[model samples]
Target: MPSSSATATVTTNVFEAGKYTTVLQKVESRTTCCPANTSPPPPVPPPKPLLIVMPCEAGEFPLLVFLHGYLLYNSFYSQLLQHIASHGFIVIAPQLYLVAGQDSSDENKSVTATTNWLSEGLHHLLPPHVKPNLSKLGLAGHSRGGKTAFASALEKAATTLKFSALIGVDPVDGMDKGKQTTPPVLTYVPHSFDLDMAVMVIGSGLGELKKNPLFPPCAPNGVNHKDFFKECKGPASYFVVKDYGHLDMLDDDTEGIRGKSYILSVQEWEVQGADEEIYRRSCGCIYESILGR
Candidate 1:
């Protein structure tokens, strides 16, 4: 069981180094050949934004929503999304805001991000079947987005949504005025079995989320993600990738971040870690936990 006093957070590869693929890259674009005098039509604003709906076999699918970390936009988290969607669950990663620089300390924006994600799902964009099964929904986020995931849960609980589970990817809790304490109050940590699901977290080298009071250790040297799983309440697992920084989890390649922190300098070419593998296994745990093997 996770200690009642505080929850654990891992932020290692949550923002480490790597070249994350873009969402636009996964989207199929239909190029229209225009006549020499023809002009492109004005872009139409969609009432409901498209949630990348990747499907697997004809079975009933569980909803998996992801919130990306700070500095990295939602579109850049495609590698992680594709990996999870491949495991048989439909996934949605909404681009809340694009965090591009250092010194991230915005709480209002964080709150808004959560609200937007909830709105995106509850909007008319979803299939009628997906709208009613709140019991089959799972919410996951990385870095600042992870904290936003918590906020999103609170919003949904107060409204017409009730998620099946919550997973934070090295989520950021530091900027929320110590709201990490809010989970034990609003969250009823799902059962180890019942489509009740689990909230297993994933981290890398420094396997813990920063800005979370529940996470007493931000970056534990040589932290073993497997060891943390023993303390986890889910019928799931925790993971710490070897030789990875925070951004590696995404597909973005880091050139200047190496100078920001010594830990961010590990080269993917020389490292032995698999960020995608860890992400796949973690999300897969969510998939299996929700739908059962």
Candidate 2:
């Protein structure tokens, strides 16, 4: 098991020599410090498709859908999506929970419905300034959402959505039943899916969930990223951020875990220092794959 105290020493330059923050720069007046607010959210008229973030720029930009982890709201990833938008991409995040109840199988359908909405209904719903390129699309998620991303990519053949790239961040496969197989999360993992597009999995070296001092560590060793990387076919990239915890990818306090760093000497701010770097590297790959660069 990797020690929580282990510090990241080997830092390979993820960015190319000439390309430095040229694509993804933090937007001014809109820092990552912005809070997540689902109240007064974007209108989700009939058919009930959750709409999170849509860029104001009107053009044929690649559309990237971010799936929120179980029990987490879509607003939690606003900063991440906005960072991608800054780099010229159209991001759409949908709330995948059902007020009645939720199941692992629900995510696949949620993604499919959202994709259908994007291709058929988005133009009628959004303002005239918002334009999305449905042809070039990508799927990304965190935790259970990450598993959902994998599922969606694998099941893309059933939907009209054509995903060119897929990304998973610290994705976890959910619990399993004795024999029943109602929900897919019970046995789902990246390796279970057949992906044709370029793939990337971003994992945390410190799998412990120390954000809450009271809660025990829940992340399983190797199951999150290593297993996924090992299962990936064709060309793929895996990045493990040393000392970073499960929820460190979110904005400063979106999850209240950022205030309490898992490591004693390192503060939460320090653990999150590599988040932007990770986003840049992943988005760079997505952009390249979508545009065929």
Candidate 3:
């Protein structure tokens, strides 16, 4: 029922915001508690609330469960999530944890719980007349969160809701090669992941380079985006923004010293104009390849 011109417009504008007005909402989980008189407390659910962004208009849209980076708050990605939502998708980003060590096993479990809660709790939280199409559901994350996304899709955690697409934005496994973190997802083998879903890996050209002598590169070599893309099988796409860093996709007003530094770097790239074009082209390619625009 769609016309060719409308499809063409979508194909050409993949890098820009779409034609929908979006709304953002933070939903807290409904927790139940037992009487304090009980001898021992029953197991409580993980307190992983969601930050949902979706179209304000009445329409059915695909859903993407986005996970935050290591120790990063879900609110930091407000701009990026809203951009995707404007493109007619509902993005649910969960605060997996307040603090975490090298182990991601618990984070993986939290993701599973959030995905399962979608069917029962999501509709109630969405805007009136707006619906989510679980069949076209996607899972995406940035930095260490990207590693978590891949692990969850590989069934490292028991997930009842199947994900149709997976995205990793400069995912990092550990400090360096052969030094992978606990429950490592990369096998160091070509096309080793058996995700059985469309995959997209977005890398940053500067991620493997050290920002200073004091700290290691945010996304170190051998365990970063390049390694992730190498192991992905067919029905996959890879994009690397040559002028960006691991945290450049975040909101411009992202707080903290690291955020300020990255914001300046982004400004430099924008001033050049050419770097921004390359970034846009890379993102547009991703939409065409994975979303079939």
Candidate 4:
């Protein structure tokens, strides 16, 4: 477990969404020119209530499935997913509700099932000209969803669906033997997972500080990032962003209150200032390096 602080330096290259255009008009125009249009379009995927974001430019884009934090809505991460999609990757973020009685293990299974569904069925819904490369797949999540992402990867390794990379942004611990539990009372036990894929763990230096006092600290004792990073054995790297909170990596409208002030009402949010720049640069750097953009 080689953990280091902010002493390390990263060449900042911010990701600009305008660089790739996946607009509706252009996508429809390209669809007309697809060579494999002889066959009729397949039916839309079953109503599983999933959020899928795709790039406008036509090509065999890579596929990515994102898991959201426990209790947090999947659509909350739309901005982040859309930004990633603009870089030529198909992102699927599924909404999981623990409040509705779903556990971490249940959510983990949902992730795997969703990935399988995408691999086997999503192509039918896409434009004939726009084919997605299922082999080049990745799993990512925030908070507890990050833990679920890691768990899903382990589960996926057993089957035929293989993931090429895994990313966890300020992941929080909330599982016990594949079950879900909240903090202070439910302690998370780490497992020696054998993952054969590139791993990137992003942590925030101040994640636990800005958390609501009423609830337990988000990244208690660094279990969220450091613990997970240390356990990863194959092709793993860790990056810690100073002065950022757990919510900083999420989309602007994550909280139902809307706008940039919601985080402030409950706890101090670090979306502005250097934190935003670091977040964008780190996201771009990892995507480019992993997806070969």
Candidate 5:
């Protein structure tokens, strides 16, 4: 269970690297079954590996299952994952799929499977003396992965583990609300989300703008972060970061030319009862910037 206090001390800049030393590990799934000699043998399934980033110290830390964006590899967020883990948390990022269609139902199911697998297989992969506190588990993603996180939390896919916090970074549901993909989550209604956990929706002011004329905006107007936040209930907060886009949160080393263009910094902390203070501080900072004070 999370701390009941509503406030936490902030001694350092949240944007900088945390105090703990972190380590990264990659775990590949190994098949235990052998194919029988039959007339028609079934094809073997591909391995779904996991990229784990956690503190190297001996202590219990909260766990967060982070999903990668559309057609993006989990390793693309290596720096971001290490940043969170350095703050005394364990981040488990799974390579859900190498390629996916418009439909995201399968991705939702994959997240569920990965979450359930933690209880049985995660301990074996972790470093000695490092413990994961499953009770404080959180679910978060970027872009399409954000939508999958929300869909999975809304019961679109069943899982035994309970997520205590939910976060969406520039999440988009297709081009608009009218053209939502499979297993749609947004209802286009204010405070309509049935999520029982604390929610945070981070938007990008530049995301709705097209980089060029040939393609649509990465995060469109009607089905973007604005829509996701408007439909959240209490214990929720929304932040719109100016001069950034949907892909800005990814690590600088992410593959492709666009990866070198921009970088966005974000800090991960426990989301039990400190959301209100964080929201208040964020609003104050925005106000000060606007007033030039």
Candidate 6:
């Protein structure tokens, strides 16, 4: 874990460099996440819920940690979450309750604690016959949640926990270095996040990307994927879907006639020209690299 004046520890990984094999194929025995061998320290994955839906065959599956945006609940992301879960990996989505008078510091602590507990608690939940070891694991979040995940990675307390990749669905804030602190070190990390697989899907909300106040303005023309992905740095790459509004990711909203769609609030959206396939591909890519099968 690399620590700076403000070290952001997104230490989500616990597995060391080892042979590629399935936990489901071997005797089931997973107890704790490996300790950090680096500076600062990794941020412990939060504990919320881990729902696993395996593929037909049993092998080591990848993990995609889902994080919803602010003022939102994990339940809201159910469609996307379940879609990812059905793809044969473990899905961990930590709920961050935003109540009145909640302090950001306290709330973040809760987030980190929950993430830690979840990472450590995985092996115990498996049935004797089912051992879940994610070959590749990562995080994907939207709106403020996306920003939180992106910024959170920069501050992971543990210097050793590296995610395969990070997906920011039209992230806002944090990316902009401010007077308070410099942009985090995630932009400079190696491919340690992913053992073998790596893919970063960056989405710009049609509503915001068109004329986003936080992200680059995407009005008349549109914001480019590079604008957002460039900030991530490292072996990280990106993807952006046009025409889709921010709320399209949610099943609740109806698509617009032209390039518009009923908003799912100021967050979450379906990518332009992308039906549900984007979700499937998102899971597919992450799944492919994590397991190394």
> Per-residue CA lDDT of candidate 5, range 1-293, in tens?
11111112233444445566777776654442233752321142223577888877799888888888877788777766665665567888888887789889889878888888777677766766998887888888888888998998888337778888888878888877688888788998889999888888878777787656656778888989999999999888788975455665565556654343322221222223432323323322332222121
Report the CA-based lDDT of candidate 5 relative to the real structure.
0.70
- Tens-place lDDT per residue, model 6, 215-270, is 43321122223434554445556655555655456544333431132132233334
Q: Which regions of candidate 2 are displaced past 4 Å?
A: 1-49, 98-102, 175-192, 209-218, 255-293
Estimate the TM-score of every prediction.
0.52, 0.68, 0.82, 0.76, 0.78, 0.57
Error of 5 at 137 (Å): 0.2
Clash count of each predicted structure = 24, 0, 0, 1, 0, 40
The most accurate candidate by lDDT is 3
lDDT of each: 0.45, 0.57, 0.75, 0.63, 0.70, 0.45
Compare candidates 2 and 3 on lDDT and give the better one.
3
| Model 6 RMSD, rounded to 1 decimal | 13.0
As for lDDT, the candidate ahead, 3 or 4, is 3
Residues 9-76 of candidate 3 have per-residue lDDT tens digits of: 23336576677767777655545223466333223322476788877779888888899887778878
Off by over 4 Å in 3: 1-12, 31-47, 256-289
Which portions of model 1 show Cα errors greater than 4 Å?
Answer: 1-51, 56-59, 99-133, 154-156, 175-197, 207-237, 252-287, 290-293
Cα error, residue 48 of model 3, in Å, equals: 1.0
| 101-218 per-residue lDDT for model 4 (tens digits) | 4346667656666676776667765667677898888888887888778777777554457889988887766432333443121233443557788888888777766446555556
Q: What's the TM for model 4? A: 0.76
Better of 4 and 5 by TM-score: 5
Clashes of 5: 0
TM-score comparison, 3 vs 5, better candidate:
3
Off by more than 4 A, model 5: 1-11, 30-47, 256-293
Ten consecutive residues with minimal summed lDDT in candidate 5? 1-10
lDDT of 2 by residue, 40-80 (tens): 32233323334344444455567788887656666566556
CA lDDT of 99 in candidate 5? 70
